[model samples]
Target: MEAHLRVRAALLLSVLALLSLLARSSSQEIQIVNAERRIDLTSHIVKVFLTLKVENIGASPASEILLAFPPTLIDRLALVKAAATVGKRKKKSYLPLDVNPTELPDAPNGTKYFSISLLNPLSAGESATLEVLYILTHSLEPFPAEISQSESQLVYYRDSAIILSPYHIKQQTTFFKTPSTKLESFTKVEPTNRAGTDLKYGPYENHPPYSFSPIIVHFENNNPFAVVEELVREVEISHWGSLQITEHYILKHAGARHKGVFSRVEYQSKPSFSGVPSFKSLLARLPPRVHSVYYRDEIGNISSSHLRTDPRKSELEIEPRYPLFGGWKASFVIGYGLPLQDFLFESPDGRRYLNFSFGCPLVETVVDKLTIKVVLPEGSKDPSAVVPCSVEQHLETKYSYLDIVGRTVVVLEKINVVPEHNSPFQVYYNFNPIFMLAEPLMLVSVFFLLFIASVAYLHVDPSIRK
Candidate 1:
């Protein structure tokens, strides 16, 4: 046993050495010719766009490019997308590429990397321009933590002034666009410039690999930070032509906490200025051709909602009993019905499936915990689910109206959900169409028994005849 352990340790050491060698060799082969980064800080969500010009400097061809992020941002990063440009000027077109997380044994400073696979191998001395869009959530800090209803919200954002890269950058610039011109303070690195609501970092030249310069910006932003602590969506399908959807929400204001008493009179009278950071209403987008929509809570049905329907989609505008301030929370439910033909389809092999949205419908809102349950018809068997991203899934039994053995529920749970997670997922199962007659047959049998009893009672002789 001791000899076996020694052999395993030696093998691990050799593998680590090989990985380190590969990491060093790749960094020397590629270089960033130019880079332009734009960051939008208008709302609670942070969006960054990077346009990179890359060239292969070594003799070998390069098949992928590495993207680096600091340890602080690794968990908060929501989505990253990359696309390569073709043609020039007005004729330019973009081809989407795959982006996946990669690990290196010799990373410096706990750095993380995402590799973007190119369409074709980049030959030596050949250059390509790639555009990447990444999103981050909960990256802003609420300064002073608590404030009165009349006070505007202030936040602090920290990031590196220089772009984090494993390859040397010849020239690069970073630009930031804020919601307003209410700047408090910002770090200046000699050439940093602030004009209106825009801030420019640098057009600096000649930066070595793994360069980083930290900076911070403090500014005033009054946008609402609406966050859903948890959202549970349940979908029930009926072969009789209707699809039912119900969503339960626990929404909270994730901004600075509200201090002192909330004065409703001041908020109502001074709508333009008072309670600038608080939100009174929210909008949800639903699929087109929705019907029987309702918004309610434990108290009763909520009457303060308006729904507009068009050929493309339906919009629901709702208001809670009170405005949501910092640290405040509200609970409610939204239910709707959709035509089965729109979302339910039968495959070539005689299996039925449901294609539905995966996350919350509110605009510009973040959900920390999300649970989706797809309740298939009562007689379904051999269930399966397909989702683009990773999710925890399990099977459950749910009893509904007229169900004998209970319906099969496909439960999917995910955390740290953003708007990018609102994609379609499918649940497939085998179901026989003959089982649709079960409910009708049961009702018919009950009526027939009642009819026979009524006829026998009429024909019975009473005591008067005796």
Candidate 2:
């Protein structure tokens, strides 16, 4: 009996060993031959572009590549996209690959991973070059946290000097493009150089997997950090040849908080230097043939606005009642009308659809929370929305002019919205042409009844003395 029990235990141990070997073999070992990382700190948004030459070092083929990021940046990351280079050097083309968040088993240092699946598996010792673009929102921090109206706004950005990767890095370099050459300070890794507004680091030697060198740079960046805390865009579709849009914005200066009282006299006198970071006017790009544009706040319509239109596009420049300084906020509304034929179309199967651009129209602005409402015409049914990314969607009901049962409103909500989210989205629904007569017919019937009542009263002569 003892011998049999020992035999069973040995078999179990052997099985465990085989499973471990299989797991290790399945995980491909990769090495980064060369990497170039460019960090753009010219504005409040952080844009990182990475070019990596990767090789599969393991015996097995690599079907996927992993990107690592620290916990601090994972939440702020707004977009991640990667493409692989194909063909020869002069004729090189890029094929976009699928990127999605993934979990790495037994990952150390609380690192987050995003997996990019390759179209073709990379064989052993084979190399491939990849280009990656990612954007982060609200990443720059105001170093002083609070500044007076006259002080130039300076901000701090923290990042790893080394390219963060799960694989071994044979060679890597990082470059920084600052807003200006007025660099207060920056961390110096050996072989770091600064030329004009650009800073370079690395050309470092081989680094083991998961190596990291934290660095920070402090510099003057007085760009307006215009951020919309909450934006609600309402798009109302009318079959009567008009597409109306109204946007409500709660905009704020997301830069350093203001410390002292804002003096308008000082700001106006020295317009060039005083309150350099503050913003008074913002430009919005509207679709072509836009009409009936209005910019207003709670008080009334703002007169300090200009509209320029051409055959292709329209621009609306608006100024708030007061200049927006750091931490200051303003709430306003912008509404416009577009010809229905420009955006609404009817499919062959008798389905009507509306293709509209998503996201805010203001330039270089980030939205913390966005809600888009598409109010279809009354009597529409089976409404659907097609957005590029995931968003919270639900059905709502809104009453408009001469609406009988209220219009079907498709509500889409998303957070951490960037300008890249401005792609076109389609909303399709089944609408009947017969319902178009509901409003006009109702109006005529009411007018006819009124006329008939007037005639009856004239014929009856209901005066008491009659």
Candidate 3:
């Protein structure tokens, strides 16, 4: 009984601490809807929706709210739909305009605010919805908008703003992990503005008499935009010995926005010159101890990339062609052969399973379309993959190479995806052994049948010809 009482005391204290945080945070209520869940490797086409919540504790009604959306996100937005309403929602007249959007505000307040939902009167206890959408066009921000060997450059967030409605908002803390040890009860978090780092933890406010979250990040222009433009991975499994992965990748300087133009002259004459960092090249990482690793591209052999794998460290390095400056592009193709044993995982209890990303690249591109063909061994054809398919508009093609009808061809079409969407697109399919042995057996049977027919026909054909 004494121990039980001690446990109860601890629990009660925890709840009290949480309440304290809620009571003290800026605009203590926040609302957000995440759509990253709707992506897959086997099937494509997707939709992302956002919903917001606001609370009204203030006596006077709230006015305009400003927020920034990254230009990358805007360009990559796929089939977007947006709507805004206040308190059970009485629609308000609103407008959209850029801050430095044109020529007036040279202010560091270079942010965008929602002039929508002016005043439909959000009653004392109500929430609102602020909607917006766009595609994920690209990554790789310019290191320095301009270059000068003499000085360092500063980079700020772009398209980053806040969603304001009233005096306070409540969004549960769910995205990142909390630190193991901390002294403060209320931790600080940087709101997701379309800006650079330097985001803060709380007193981050939200709705009611909505005031924007007061925080920003500034840094000396220095992170290189090391990005891969496109990646295509193909795994061919041969029942006999190998699982071959033939991959093609495109490298680019998604950050080619120069202030004026490239200045090699200015670049050469600097004392420890400081300017925006350009993407001169790229690097590709391969899995452990991959044998016969051949790296090439459509143009030919990519001599610039480096490949290395230490049995101890198990690492591989693949580099790019020329130094990628702002606004340049290139492609690469590489292949690796592995043993089938790599895919087989046996459990302590004797169960079997496979964990793989059915041909999904971490960062995708303007993929107009994609077709994935999975080949099983001889006599193995009936394979069933369940779940993890997203918003697929259609799925009809069913065929393959040299197998009676061909293995199944699954195609997924997705656009406006960024580096963040890469992981979720990788899917895990569950299959049994029957489908594993179909390809090889079918090949041998056809070869032998042809040989038998050839022998029987020789005598009759020769006599008829004479």
Candidate 4:
């Protein structure tokens, strides 16, 4: 009877051990209450916005949360901004977050992790909301990857339908916002929702942590995804003349490349061919006070441009010499003049200030690298500048027409800039009135000296004749 009792006791001990292990596993997993993802697809770039409501179901307080990206987009991901708010409050107070990369064995191949540190440690059963914004470059690949000049371009986009979180998700949804409504085909997951140009996927429930559902979308986007490989914008401030703004762009088509040599005959034979995803023309909006404008390419001035001016605003439309195809390049220069009074302000204390904006490109585009050089007037001192975006600034000397002393050139460099960054920058400096008069005085003095020498030479007749 004692032996039988021992066997039963051992079996009960084994069951208890198994239950303990299961409880520990459940406690270690974080719980996601909700996940909302928004993806905006432009020509070549994709912007992702994710908002997650999470709770720490672990036994200990959680200090960091992990965000995982699919293997395809891991290398192209760029974190823009991230923030978090604690609990449900009438007035939400957001806290800045730090994002760093991490790796987990269970994640898919090429997966990258963004570890966000919480401002306050999330106690067990407590929840926090996180908002993350990021960009993915070259995410949309052409369906054929290469097309003829007369073919319509279709792009293929693939991503995980579910948010790759390292936690149990109670509910989740994804919305895809495209530039056009002409969708050719998309993988239809059940319980999908669609409205206008947006495709909403899921209200998925009871998904285990770290699960992934691959989704592929094909859409007809016959639009030029103009990508400025390089941009050099120069802003010259002059006390006498208008503010001269010039931008030189090396523009390239980010869509699929041509399979064979481009045929001008076929392209012209089809009048509808011009509407394909090719870079044909761009329209830029100029400030109302613009005085002069010009557009030219590397070969020479392009005459196929038009300018329309009104009392309030002006527009400059320009077309390239040839339709830009994938992998082909075109370089062009555009410049305009804006009145000084529009940007420059004078204070009673003789302090000068300037406010100006680098307007968007003529078309929807992305700039890989942008360099802005602002040349201040000669002898300007105590210069201070404020730019809307993050930039690398440096001071240089520039010598221009009739400049006695070199001008102060403020060089600002930025990367991964889009057309939406159309905000004005403020620059304050101290300008002496005497400096403004220096150029005029020098010109007058030179002319007077030349006149006197000319008169003296004329008076001295050819005495060699005697």
Best candidate per TM-score, number? 1
The estimated TM-scores of all candidates read 0.95, 0.92, 0.50, 0.76
lDDT for model 1, please: 0.93
Model 3's alpha-carbon lDDT is 0.42
lDDT of 3 by residue, 1-466 (tens): 9999999999998887766554333233322321111111111122233344444554544442233333234444433333554344355543332222111121124322223333455554554555443233332233455443344434332221233332334432212111122111222345432212222233333223333433223334333443454554555555566777776656554433445554666655642452345544334444555788776767677666566666532334455555445456667777776656766444554443333443334233243233343343334333333323333423333345655644433334443334333332322233456655565677888888998888887745555453
Candidates' RMSD to native: 2.3, 4.0, 17.5, 10.2
lDDT of 4 by residue, 1-466 (tens): 9999999999998877777565445435578899999998755668888998888877778787777766667656633567997556787777878877765544456666778888888888898889988887667888888888777888988988888866789999999987778787888877787777899999899887668888888887777778888999898999885899999999888888877677777777775764377767887877786777888987788899898889898888888898888777889999989889888997677788888775355656777788888889999888777886667888889998778888998788877776556678877889877898888988999999999999999998876763
TM value for model 1: 0.95
Show model 3 residue runs off by greater than 4 Å: 1-156, 159-210, 213-222, 226-229, 258-276, 310-314, 344-353, 358-401, 412-466
Candidate 2 similarity to native, TM-score: 0.92
Tell me the tens digit of each residue's lDDT in model 1 across 167-202.
999999999999999999999986899999999999
lDDT of 2: 0.92
Tell me the deviation in Å of residue 37 in model 2. Answer: 0.5
The lowest-lDDT stretch of 10 consecutive residues in candidate 4 is 20-29
Candidate 2 off by > 4 Å: 1-27, 88-90, 459-466
Better of 3 and 4 by lDDT: 4
